[model samples]
Target chain A: MSGAGEGPGHGLGGRPTTGARTRSIAEAAWAAAGRDGERNGHGRTRLQWLMARFGRGTVIGIPYIWLLLFFLLPFLIVLKISFAEFRIGLPPYTPLLEWIEGGYLQIKLAFGNFLFLLDDPLYVVAYLNSLKVALVSTLIALLIGYPMAYAIARASPTWRAVYLLLVILPFWTSFLIRVYAWIGILKNNGLINNALISLGLIDSPLPLLNTEVSLYIGIVYSYLPFMVLPLYATLEKMDIALIEAAADLGCRPFKAFLTVTLPLSMPGIVAGSMLVFIPAVGEFVIPDLLGGAGTLMIGKVLWSEFFNNRDWPVASAVAIAMLIFLVIPIVVFQYYQHKHAERAEES
Target chain B: MTDTLVQGTHSASSRPEGSRPGAVLRRAEARPIIEIQDVVKTFGDFVAVDQVSLTIREGELFALLGGSGCGKTTLLRMLAGFERPTAGRILIGGQDMTQVPPYDRPVNMMFQSYALFPHMSVEANVAFGLRQDSLPKAEIRDRVRQMLDLVQLGPFAKRKPHHLSGGQRQRVALARSLAKHPKVLLLDEPLAALDKKLREQTQLELVGIQERVGTTFVVVTHDQEEAMTMADRVAIMDSGRIIQVDTPHALYEYPNTRYVAEFFGTVNMFQGQLIEDEPDHILIRSDALANPVYVGHGISARGGATVWVALRPEKLAISRVQPDSPHNWDQGIVEDIVYLGGISTYHIRLDSGALARVTTQNLERMAEPDITWDDRVFVSWRHDNTVVVTG
Candidate 1:
């Protein structure tokens, strides 16, 4: 096909127009042709045919629309609610915008919700405990996942698939059911305590469940796959020659691993940590089910504030504060991702 | 003190008197820096390296040249302590190194992909081995700087491997490997990753570095030209065994077997039988030629035994008329003429239904020959030019 009338300089009928106007006019013409294909006698035009089916904008707009609807919209709603006052009403929160007398608009935003969160020492302790649990669990997951990921990555192709599948196999079960199963394994009369008591390794049933230790175990077990998969991805793609080169340069095998393998897989480490830590910071179900009374986590606090105390505005404020707390790790994760992409492009 | 240290550690141990490039071939008594005794490496049921024994002299740039999967790389890995031989022992500087790990051994390797640490700067990469040795920080810095300067990568000391070009990254890998001044340096396909022009340039630069550092280098390459251009002595391997090991000149001029003759360069093999067996001369009767091929040398073969004569394309002459020598000349019709810029090759189909290739140097301005396709020509070679292989 000749591209005579397709470029920016030319319009139909040898007319001159600006590029944007030309584009709009062309789009209209294409739309008209699409509506009545036999009018032009050459069937539908290429632009009309293609754009009417699927264009670049529609392809790229799909994910944007998804994020806008599901993520940004919900986040804006939460932000708006966080500014409202708590009230004993149907929705249980005062509206930020309201119609007033004298035909004047009244906008009442209560900053007291945020101030109240700062005033309550219980909320502060819960935030700190949440961070502590998330940080400790993430470190534990990394410690356990790195070696497992390394083993899977170094395995043969056939065994590699099997090992990766094994890592993901736990996900096939219901998440809540798996956490409940951990309760059965960690409780005072559960599997470990019974085995230890029968083996004469302990005198009595240990207070294993409903404690901080059990909470750590539950979080680490659930998020360990998240850590291992990304680590495996990076480790599998890494050049094995680098390790060999390190060893050949008079570096011991373990030292080679510490120098080469660990540093190179930093991107995967950051990514996996962010994935586990972000959801973990606001994790609700695990702490609600497995945490003891002393385990004051922000998730449990947020849940009780919204449900038991019926304080939606305060819970929303706590959520917003938790987000502000997590922005640093998210930014760190994004920075590593950007650096990794830049290095990939360079090589 | 520095002078004594430099000489005492590296060149003093490796480089003997008169042990330069060409001179090393004559020094038969030069100390062997690496000795592989009956080394056999197997992966499961498949034997990667058979019972092979090799001795590499100190300060020699040796090449293990072969095609892919020919066990050249496997042998190099065994030398680097990455793979333990299933059965034999390796010695470096007359010490048993078979049971020793790579870090414990005094050897370094430059990977084919260069394998420069993407995270580390050029300086840090070169200093990696030195740091492992727990050298003083000041000494490590000085040696790193010296190594970078040696590879002409001083300006790129702060740059990461990904930030540099392929050639520059290769230089970084070289510098890193050479910084340790190990007893041996193994290079796995060092020039295989570069473009043709850069590969030729790097080949000479590598030889220069090897000589200046005075370290024994064992390089593995599938490219014959790379091996010939860079190696002081090349061991051509095939199918888990070394076919032959000799100087580049000798390997090219006098190949021992048919595989060696064909593998090193282009050759036209004629199936024949030994007709005359004499102390001074031997003659071959061939079905591929109307004439008997004469060699001005004796062979340890009986009469009427089957033999093959290998002649390089450049060694054979093409002419429109027959020469005075009737024993070594044959008449053939030109099937094709390949006019390369520097030289031209003529594919000649002999009357005996055998095809032969003859290359002539295009020395003159009008070197485009008058001889075209279907033109009859005579192909002749001197008796000494023929390489006879019993295998």
Candidate 2:
């Protein structure tokens, strides 16, 4: 690995034309090597320095490329396939990247399915329902969960731990289990129905199951913890002095809460709602299990298009459409977070 | 004229004739705006405020000064109706306000953290209390504007807490607290968050504002300098009891306890016994030095009572040679010297292990450095300069 094995006169460090100059160059290189610390630099070479320059690429660049490949690439593929026409018994058809004689293909494409979606009312309704359901569920969850979060925040330290545990415990168990458990209370012959009938509250089972009410309950149940955690984080960090300060400023308890506590808790509410709403928009299972076959949702529609109708192109198109619906809000939320971080820095 | 008005309305035929409105009004006329009458607040077994009592004048800027956990904040909270006294009552404007909740109390508190509402506009935060009282919309707006203007925050009304600077946010909190027009304003470490220079300026401004508003102010602070500069009367607390309550100058000149003398500021304390009592002056023989110290006050207490005499650093004269003025003479070797600008402090180690710190103002550039580290020096204070502590 060394120029030493070869003549000292014949290497990159040497003046190749003359032996004495080469020897002098070798001696200088050796002195530089000797100046190194206890960790030996004797065997170091130009190749290691060159490799170190590109070393960070292996760490940061690989994950970046990998995410682009597995995550971004799949999304783009869905977008590409979405523009293709769907046919019965055919996988989603696309003209993207057809092989050429040079063993290469077309690299870029356009949005025909997006045009088809815009022209159709059902697709538009799906987008609207998703937005409607997600927003409604998030609002309901926040309204119910803030008090619980506040109670948790103000509770004794031991009780706070217990309450927070109860809030998050549902999340630790399988999401499916919680959804199914809701069905037991919601079904016609299930807990609520049976209890009501047995107690002579109703002669017949009410049409409570397989309704938007049931779907709403399921959505709220699934996302309530999301709202509570963020709200708790904000509420717990709140200075009790702030409440006292407000009260001292002539506010009654209710007014103090309205002015100080509620306003300060808005960031938590916004953050929590964003988290709950975004995922709930794409929710397939909860609505499916509780919504019955008549449920008209974007996720359900996409699921049916893929499995029931065997329209792969439309399924991919639905996935892309879902993404298009999501992108703006995500960007907005991330921008808010970044701004908050900056404000935190300034303060 | 005020006394006749009260007596005319009272029932003179009541059981004890003189104990009626006549006496009550007479007492009320001279009484302070606030009185903590044997107010004791105990949390479990820890007495946060132990039977403390003090009077605050109608427009006095009073300070409760102490170190952390010294019950200053607790006392302030009790006064503000945030904490209930365990065994005694607090009177505000001659009304017993012990059971009153913080929201209902006439007093308003500016919290230590400057707790401005994060979500509201600065104007909205200020308007909150007025709105709570169900004031008319126009009146609420007017008062909010007035408060903001008072705090010089009228232009920044729409700015949120995060958008404003620390000082601006602090002003918003100040505005909000003042908007209520409280009977008395309680400030808990009001300028603690500001930088040193800003704190000093704000302290002066706070005193001016309190005076202008004509509201009594009770400020709780751990910083001795803040308490001294801001308070008309300072109550020094230690271990949940008020050690001494007096004007800053009085407390410095006539400390009632060794703890109060040391806690208020830096002092060179000598453990001593009373040697003689005089009408104009008293002499105290100290174990730390060869001579006795003469203080301004006369002490008549007996021979064996352990006592202390305190000397402020600036009052003590330091010289490398023997003192030419003989009556107030003492000696020590300079253990350490710190050359602070405008004044240099000499920490002189005595025959006793205690180090007596003496500061001399660097008044002249022509004067040679009198004492340096390890230089044996004579330090003395005038008879009138020394303060006595008999605790």
Candidate 3:
């Protein structure tokens, strides 16, 4: 190809070609070609550089965009609605921002909803009641789940698989169905009352359903697997030799568990507790289905405000306040996760 | 004071009324710290340890050496009170400890994996056993410091097990097990995880620690070299049975069976029939040899009884010309030569197609080859070097 290009320049011009003249002409042609090649190479590299940048941008930007569109955008919309005034309309709330004449923006936000929640004792009681219920149910779930997780982790390989399957088997049925099943078992004419009355332990059917006790049972039963799964993962990966080492060092079996097994499974405990606690605080179905009028929970109040009262602004305000209240625990959970990841990396 | 009190009670309880005088004398001379009497451990249909019996002397470093399924670890676990014998008994320091739980037994074990608590610092790990006894805080601190110093890990006491090197973690495990001053210390392949250089150094360190503490240490190991280097006496185990127990030197030089001889090191065996048996000397005619081989000592075997002569590779010498020795010599052609830095091994093939290995030290540097491949050579050994076995 180079020879063919050179043939046109050297052979067509037939004036007595001297050595110096031929060399000068070849050098000019070479310089021109070098300039063209440089331009082409630069353009190619520039395109490649942009392509590489786009590749990295896609990897990182996609997740950020997903969070923004699906999570952050919805949260901002709720926040905006929380500030708007309530009105009888198709959307049931007025817009907080409006454009006036001369292209000037006017903003109107109502603080009355937040002020009304603070003034009303019912909202305050519901918040406190929800927190108390969540705390007690999480404790119950932890107590029942820890021993189950430890047993499954220490079981033989074949038995371990079976135990894990049993732990997760409740998920096969619909969650709402499981919650509804608890009502039948815990009601006055249900299994527990009937069995107790038939055994002559009770003179009549006691009021078991539509009570705080039923709420606690439903929450614990539904969230028990969440508590056990993370705990099992941590306990199963634990080295059994540590417990044996403790026993060999003169520790009794129970003390060995406290000193070695319990301390080492702290990460799992924290993870499992967060998983159960976060969801239990906002629990609505169990409270609505099993809780009586005495059990005033924020989730049921929020549901009533949105659907029964047709109060969108107050419901949005309630949701925003609940999120704000939960931020501290969520931050604490994130800090724990971060610390655990760092510890893992160091080891 | 507590040690003496415990020992007194143990002896008073275990000693029979008017015990044999010989038994009392033996106890006074060198008491058996741990006695494993006819212990048998069976898992379902498989017998892990079959009626194994051994007595480890006080302040002795004993090793159980065997291959993987030979029940060495199971025997050690029994000593540690981790496994209950299906039959027979285990006694520690003259006390019946067969029914005792591990936490109550006066024994500690250094696990093979080092089993250091990842969540605790080295000082805490060493102090765990001491704390279990509810000792005074001041005493626990002093004892933990002393153990850390003994292991040369004073600077690393504040570090967790994961932060320390493998050798350092191993020392922590050793110090933790030794901290409580238990009557017996069991080590299960303690140095198996360390590299070769670290393993050799740690083996010597282990021996030193055991001697200084005067604790009866029963180490279970599959590496023959490690067992021989670290133990005062080695017990070779095979197929859930104690095959032989002897000092390392005696076990190597005078192995009673072909299994013991081969397990300790490489040995070449010749199957033969005993043709002549005298009081001082014996003759065996082997098919691998052109003539009958002679030994200095005789065994009580009838004529024409099948026997085996086990010869170690290092004991045999190879030469190009036939030696002046009248017996214990064979003519063969060198097939392969492995030149190790310190020693050279020559594989020679006899006329009967039997292979024999002869190893010689490179005492002098050789610029030119003295023996190369495919050279006809004679391999000979002293009559005392050959061990005869009749099964």
Instruction: For residues B15-45, write the lDDT of model 1, one tens digit per residue.
Output: 4333254565564567999999998999999
lDDT of 1 by residue, A118-218 (tens): 89899899899899999999999999999999999999999999999999999999999999999899888899999999999999999989998888988
Clashing pairs in 2: none
lDDT digits (tens) for residues B17-117 of candidate 3: 21334443453467889889999999999999998999888877789999999999999988888889999999999999998988999999999998899
The per-candidate TM-score of the B chain, in the order shown, comes to 0.93, 0.88, 0.92
Estimate how well candidate 3 is docked, as a DockQ score. 0.62
lDDT of 2 by residue, B1-391 (tens): 1233223223222223122345334434654989889989999999899889888877767889999999999999888877889989899999999998887888888888877776678888888778778899999999988887677777899887878877777778777888888888888898899999877767766765665677788899999998877776788999899988877777777787889889878898888888777777777788787677776666756655677878889898887778666456678788888889898988988866678888888899888885678888888878888777777
DockQ of each: 0.68, 0.49, 0.62
Residue B223 lDDT, candidate 2, scale 0-100: 93
| Model 3 bad stretches (over 4 Å) | A1-65, B1-28, B324-326
- TM values, all candidates: 0.89, 0.79, 0.88
Arrange candidates by lDDT, descending.
Answer: 1, 3, 2
Which regions of candidate 2 are displaced past 4 Å?
A1-63, A86-128, A156-158, A193-208, A331-347, B1-31, B119-172, B273-285, B292-300, B318-329, B369-375, B381-386
Candidate 1 docking classification? medium
Q: Candidate 1, clashing residue pairs?
A: none
